[model samples]
Target: MTGCLDDLDITMVEEGFTTKDLLETLLKEASQRGSREAFFVADLGDVVKKHLRLLKALPRVKPFYALKCNRSKEVVHLLAGLGVGFGCAKKPELALVKSAGVPVDRIICTGPCKQMSHIRYAASQGVQLMTFDNEVELGKVAKSHPSARMILSLATDESRSSGCPSVRFGATLKSCRQLLETAKDMNVEVVGVSFHIGSGCTDPQMFTQSIADARLVFEMGAELGYKMHLLDIGGGFPGAEEAKGRFEEATNVVNSALDLYFPEGCGVEIIAELGRYYVDSAFTFMINIVAKKEVPLDQPGSDDDDPGGKKSFVYHLNDGVYGSFSSVIFNNTCPVPILHKKLSPDSPLYSSSLWGPTGDGLDRIAEGMDLPELHVGDWLIFETMGAYTGPASSSLSGAQPSRIHYAMSRVAWQAVQLLQGKLLPPEEEDQECTCAPLSCGWEITDTLCVTPVFAPASIM
Candidate 1:
């Protein structure tokens, strides 16, 4: 797959349609099928490219994809096929990865406090790599899986973490010695150290500091007569295009830190658990505008006293806080909207507030947005939605969570075939193919083909 794409000078394989073009096509198709709510369009080609980018930027570290980000089987299967490992935090996520045919060794069960049953199940399934930050968890592991390989998780600098996990997980520096001693006493193997700088991390220095902290833990374990070989740098990588500069900065810092702390041939294997970095920009969400209301506003300094002189528009969409927009409330996400139809520069703009379909007052999508006046039936699109969106959406208020539609460019499929060491069908060598299961509500063409896996009945 690398060789096939290395010869091509293109940044992204031409899928024969821009995002707007594909959005329009899908909107038309959804209208015909009577889909009143939002749906997702996943560009598998983009996802593959992101993986390549990660390899280029941080070549030394292997990434274990966090399934909590986007658990679509299609995404998981594609990553697994591409040789990416899986990071499962829950039993179901582990089951999903196992169902995708991922090797037991390629999966890591990563949660600070894991269920006893889950620990037993993982041990039974041959998943030896797990994480712990507290004494109780160590006790659980020692009793349930004595021979299990463990990674000690340390608390990161809270100021550097965007979504700080120190408050909930991670052992402090002062507590690391005691934990290692306990593990040594219990005869539980402490084979590595791990720390999360939090999700959506912005400070590159955080990584260097975390690495320094991990080094301390590594030395502490070594003093306890344990051979530490693994260093799990937990997830916090940003996945948005706007964060490219920050990501690069952080990657450079991580590379430098690895060289300084765990240099080449140091007998230490490095790995990362990245969630949003792999899939955030690979999806585009389209939501339908079901209703709208015009609110009259009075301008304090206007010569005309008519309240109608200034107006604010309220838009009601089929998906809301309980649905894909849950990220707005949960992740502190602020998704910007792109209209299906481009508005003229001279077009009138209004103060608009986008609302979710739910009756709850907190189900708002966006407030005080400046947008061209839109009518009912128009669509609002959100990008960089693949992370922490789909899996977190709920079916509250009778609003079904959005369905995912996977589309891979022709070049992407070729890359997949190359990576999997499979020959392209003779008939499909020069022509595109449209294949969809009868049960799915998709109309795929030759150029852009859809994967058969639809949205699961339940999300993460």
Candidate 2:
């Protein structure tokens, strides 16, 4: 069975197969039977379940999984199965989600740029909601699809945006008002007001500010005799763990803003489009170290004088910035990579930098971070990689993006069933034991103890 599962404390359902055990078995077989190059193991099912749980927890808010995050067909299909709507940025994403049998009504056509073909396709597909920032787009929609439904995105706190509305997205309050009035004149249905506070935002007040801005626009729309039918709070929610504080703060702001603007029974449909917050932490990247080396570091003097030298350990992994580490570049955060092989608790930790397989100078994933000195053939597992790691990192470069391997267990169910049956097996009474000689991605070269898949107490 998987020693990984033992560490994770997951019990398996199949006879003698703990979740880790199964992964171990798979890795063992794959190493011998499959390509050595990296591939992501997308546990499609687990990702969906986690998103569903988040959605359920956020009552009164619907999730429109940002398709720009991870566009994997498997991921899209799973989100569809979970009944989560999609926030599509372009034609391909729209096509991918639609191809998965997701009804057009369930998709929101989002994105700063709108090509004629994509917009026309969205209109023809009966997309219920699209966002626009200016009258030019309104005129385009009016010229192409007069009956298309759309949202007027209001620019909020330009000071907060790196480039503001000029970032080439969203219209100013004045422009939004003009756009809505134009929609009225052109017979286009202006359904709602939408705004984005940018991505990787952790402050809920930013959302509150956006909401307040939307409310002002709503009032403006009302003065112009328009009854907005929707409030599309565009994607910005953080993942369960990574963005928890931010999400909570944002939620409070949103709830208060909604109360202040449109109380319950206001007849306006409220929606939040979340991407990173919903999926980022639900996945992990498990990659094997293909090679390792000692690289020297140059220490430069504070001035133009002494350029003394420094030395540090560098571990090159299969995945890098061109792969799944783009989040580091974007989020200013590096995922924690834990060593899978056993080590002395007292062993001295070595500071090192993580690098990808690319020979390019910019291919470094992490630069000079403190981590255990690792060796070749060791496995490095980065947790909380579910969000932008997959689609954001995948490339037609050396070794395609890593594949995802999924694991889940009905621990509560097994416990309940065991109590009802009341018959304890020998495996249930035995002590817990895990495997040894661990390798990355779970290629088990040796066995230490026989792992019990199911034990009454353990399951409970």
Candidate 3:
């Protein structure tokens, strides 16, 4: 509703249509062309659902979607239109969000270690909010972006219990005084406190402890003559529906903690950096099996038996760890494969491993899979691939990332529009239609705001 929706090339689908239907259509087209090209189908509707969940569950805390998770312009635009703030770690991400017509106030320049040029660029663009964790970072910010409103990045002491000090980021509690003093001496305005309890944290007590620590820091900032009005409890909520219970539990913990630590009418603005929670389950990655091999391991002292029966299969897919499945290497994500073709109810399962087309030993995507025999050109759909896969994908060794197709059901489109206060009077359902180029202007064909309208039917 805030940004222009006419520019987005979204495949408007019927209410009953799902991403699987769109993926099936594309897979059929690919098979017909004798092409084993891999691609992704992103449900923009899912993103809207996730955003609404955040607003409904944690009404007090605003969510700033980390662009590091997925910088897909379609997502950025949709979120912008929905009035979600952005957390950008670099200048390019800032530019990406800004290109979607996001205001500077809605964009916070994040990360402790930032380039001078990036700071200068953000300052030049009238971006005011930023975060820092050290005296050196404070000095840099004071020199580069004097008018910058800074949030101190506080590090949690979880490692004190876990006995792993090396896994932590941000400034320690003992050093908070020195950092605040240095910021004051330099005339740098330290506006608030922020902390990240790492990604994928499962314990709600960790968030509780972190929130308590932030309360201490906020008190410290106030004593040092800082306003300390903002508190950013960084994100680690699960992404997929299977983990919905955990997400709800975590939000409940966060809300209770906020009430106890920085209650309502406390004059402190609250926000969270939500990365995986927003996009991970929205995009489904589909890759074709390019090659397969029977792998055998030696059986010692098996004089009467053949080792062939114990052999496992290694199937190479079009995209792998280096490309669309980079989360395998970075986040240790285990991608579950969904066969495009159905097998018999009693179909025997075989031990299988999956690798990439590049043939690099390090390019393995997944292993310990019990899948039926798959051949060349067969497809495997990997759901929840939207988190860190797309933006971090590499073309290393000619491993091209899958082309992305964006879509949303007509009902979902209407819901988001209505939620954003941009939906017009009631209208008929959108007919079966594909995507149009973003450069083309769209107008209303019926009573709705969108006109009745890809590679695989849509592009964003």
Which candidate achieves the best lDDT against the true structure?
Answer: 3
Q: State the lDDT at 21 in candidate 3.
A: 84
Query: Residue 346: error of model 2 in Å?
Result: 3.1
Q: Score every model by TM-score.
A: 0.84, 0.75, 0.87
Off by over 4 Å in 2: 1-23, 31-35, 39-57, 158-168, 242-246, 299-311, 391-396, 408-460
Q: Total clashing residue pairs per candidate?
A: 0, 18, 0
Model 1 has a clash total of 0
Write model 1 residue lDDT over 266-339, tens digit each, in one string: 99999988888888888889888998887655432112333234667788888887778778887887788988
The digit string of per-residue lDDT tens for model 3 on 2-48 reads: 55566777888875567888888888788789887888899987887
Which regions of candidate 1 fall more than 4 Å away from where they truly are?
1-15, 296-309, 391-395, 423-460
Scored against the true structure, residue 146 in model 2 reaches a CA lDDT of 77
Q: What is the C-alpha local distance difference test score of each model?
A: 0.75, 0.61, 0.78
Q: What tens-digit string does per-residue lDDT give for candidate 2 at 1-460?
A: 1001223322334323343454455567767985454544333324533453444344566667888877766566655655678889898999888877788777988876688888889887888688888777777777877777888877656455433333357787666667777878888887788777665454557777777778888888888888887887776665554444666666667777888776888888887776766556545566778777655444311121212223357667777776777766655665667676788777665557677777666666765465556778777666667566643444433565566554443432222222233323223222444322111111111221112222211110
Could you report the Cα RMSD, in angstroms, for every candidate shown? 9.0, 10.7, 7.3
List the lowest-lDDT window of 10 residues for candidate 1: 451-460
Residue pairs whose backbone atoms clash in candidate 3: none
Better of 1 and 2 by TM-score: 1
